[model samples]
Target: MPALCWNQRRRDFYAITTDVSTEGIRFRSSSRLSPGEDLTCSIRHIGLLEARIDRAVGEEFTVSVRGGRSALTDLARQFVALSRAQDLRPEVVRVHHRIVPKQKIVQVTLDGGLGVSGHVLNISASGVALLVEQSLEIGATIQVGRKLARVMRHFTHGVGAAFLEPFEPSAVHEAMTL
Candidate 1:
């Protein structure tokens, strides 16, 4: 009955449906919900409409929408028309060690014969995975991309690089491309 949008932040989709009696549309997901969790949305018909998940009612999320009634109506109409035309089948790729994306591979050349080649695996808001030929002991300093990070923990074939400074995405992406 109303338009639905995807919450990119919370990784969910939502819409305002008159089909149901609730003031906001229902978002269905299995993820644990806490109050004030962020949400984002994309409109198939109206392009992308992002918003925050305002509330959680059981397994359904209620979105806090922006824009006026006319805009909402237009977006809803487009969503309905386009939503029925698409078929989406999603697949998941799981790994034993959490993989970080958009990373680069480089050869770490220490002062001694500790030089080794490895790749940057999982990257995060705080750290990165310096996958290497050897899993260095914790607190060991290893070169990742360009900077040296201490080995926070030993993973399967790598060590989590805990930077004294944060790992910048741009630098990591550049290193990975090389």
Candidate 2:
């Protein structure tokens, strides 16, 4: 499985998992990892997994699972699900609005004026997918630029938010450009 690795204080980097077991996982990363370093590992569709470096040999490293055996079990399950999903044809679903790809850096303000930075993955008249470092609880309301939105789903990169009201294309374009 493809994985992401990043130190607590640094940005995430792409990695590939060589093996995984109930105890831990072995992966290769371009980023140098020191033993005992704290890092977060994220695999597509598996969500985030907390781990600590246990050993490093060249670019290959072994990380001890911090989420315990249950985390590994969940990871295994996700791997199986992903493999099964590959055999199915992609499904087409209609939505209230057309989604367009738009990558833009924007500031999000949560309740209490707490602010976080996120990258807009895509935007539609009624919703958006944002890539952020912070994890927000589902159903939390946040202000994306001047628009109010509610968190709908959590992804490996960040959260999906549905806006309180539909946005005009010009308004979305104008806001995202900032």
Best by TM-score: 2
Over 82-127, each residue of candidate 1 has an lDDT whose tens digit, in order, gives 6576655566332232335554666765435577887766665356
- By lDDT, who's the top model here? 2
Once all C-alphas are superposed, what RMSD does model 1 give against the true structure?
17.3
CA lDDT of each candidate? 0.56, 0.81
TM-score of each: 0.36, 0.45
lDDT of 1: 0.56
Task: Give the clashing pairs for model 1.
Answer: 3-76, 5-41, 6-40, 6-41, 6-42, 7-40, 7-41, 8-40, 100-122, 104-176
Model 2 vs truth, CA RMSD: 17.7
What does each candidate score in C-alpha RMSD?
17.3, 17.7
